[model samples]
Target: MINKMQILSLTALGNLDAYIRYANSWPMLSAEEEKLLAERLYYNGDLDAAKTLILSHLRFVIHISRNYSGYGLPQADLIQEGNIGLMKSIRRFNPEVGVRLVSFAVHWIKSEIHEYVLRNWRIVKVATTKSQRKLFFNLRKTKQRLGWFNENELRIVAQELGVCSEDVREMECRMSAQDISFNPFPDDESSDRKLTTVMTHLRDNTSDFANGVEEDNWEMHATNKLTNALRILDKRSRHIIRARWLNENNKITLQEIANGYGISAERVRQLEKNAMKKLRTAIEA
Candidate 1:
């Protein structure tokens, strides 16, 4: 277990035999040896003592992580989580509790592995309630073979597990189901199958392309009419309209235009209003 993390980093796990040979090399600690190491680390804050305690316990972490292999997860990942749990247990272990570190560490190890399994088991979570969570970890143990349970088997499992048959059936369905992509790739093998994905055939009717194009054309035509209409205004009013509304990058206040023309701001505003009325009438015509 001590060499497990280093081996993971420095070598390929693609070859199974070499990996097994490495796991076999770490020495197991006797009860007396483990307790002494635990005491040294707990009482004196000895760094080497803590390392020895952790290193010696890595084999057990591997042993526990292996039990979770049925969930179709990577075995190395499970062992890594269990190792984390073991470190936590070492940090919290009380030598005065009169239990060996391995005996006490089992809960912490299994708990970390349980969390990992639940999170990765499905794209959508199969178990959220307390009863369902209990079933997630222990449900497989109740199964004797492959495929769905018959009526009698469902009743038996439900009674033994203290859950209803409906819950069992629901969980089984969730377990059997696979994740689907909402928007399939263009390179998907079958055009017909790709069309079956939810997003492929759906349309947003509110923003229909033909209606959008017609509205855009009408708007452009109205803009051309307005531009021609502005030609009817005198220079001063035309300048006011362009400054006040058209040129977003360089707009001027009525007072600024009034200062340039040597008129009151009120007079400039009246001219601006008259220009708009004439432009509207011209555009309508």
Candidate 2:
């Protein structure tokens, strides 16, 4: 009996508990009534029958969404995703198979929610393989007391989940490791006050000094090679190469060089190519 407008109003104004109660209150259909609706929607392609089926199931999506609230995702978004899954199930549902719509929709609803959790939980996904993904969820339930799992417990969980003990340990480590802010500043620090942030930790004085010395040596070696390569070029070719690549600003075009030397643009390009080849050969030697 609920219209689209009424459903929209209820969704907008009602709290989570109110929605739960409203959905639960929808009368459970008798076998005869369900069969009739399923036949109409499935065989006859009756959209009105489909709409009724979906509205009746909206409450079920809300119920499943409640279970996932512990994941730190917004409840509204989870409900929306679950609703999408419910719709998909409705479209693919086979009423001739004799299963109730609620039973069929459960898998679809949970699949959509699981995908959302994996994608949003961390920037880098913690679970890649099938066993790791299973452990990622199951291991949370297996924990008896917080802290870390003991060796025996780890082995037991590995046996139960049919994964290696090492995988369980790795997943546990990943789960326990919280994301740290890249540039965390002290809470009490004022806007004008300059406090050392995480960036400060990136610099180790000894490593930095060594890196600087190595970089300087690399630049000096590169400069020597470049200077030696330039020496191998004829004057005009060297000038063309420098103008095309080495100049900081106001680089001359091939046409400008050609005009200056009273030569064609193609001739200038050929000279530049020859110069580059000679430089490369000298550098390699």
Off by over 4 Å in 1: 1-20, 145-147, 187-197, 200-285
Residue range 35-60, candidate 1, lDDT tens digits: 88888878887767777777677778
Top-lDDT candidate index = 2
Question: Which candidate leads the pack in TM-score?
Answer: 2
Give me the overall lDDT of model 2.
0.81
Worst 10 residues of 2 by lDDT: 1-10
TM-score, each model? 0.60, 0.61
Instruction: Tell me how far the alpha carbon of residue 70 in candidate 2 is from the true structure, in angstroms, after superposition.
Output: 2.9
lDDT of each: 0.80, 0.81
Backbone clashes per model, in order? 0, 0
Looking at model 1, which ten-residue stretch has the lowest summed lDDT?
A: 2-11
> Candidate 1: which pairs clash?
none
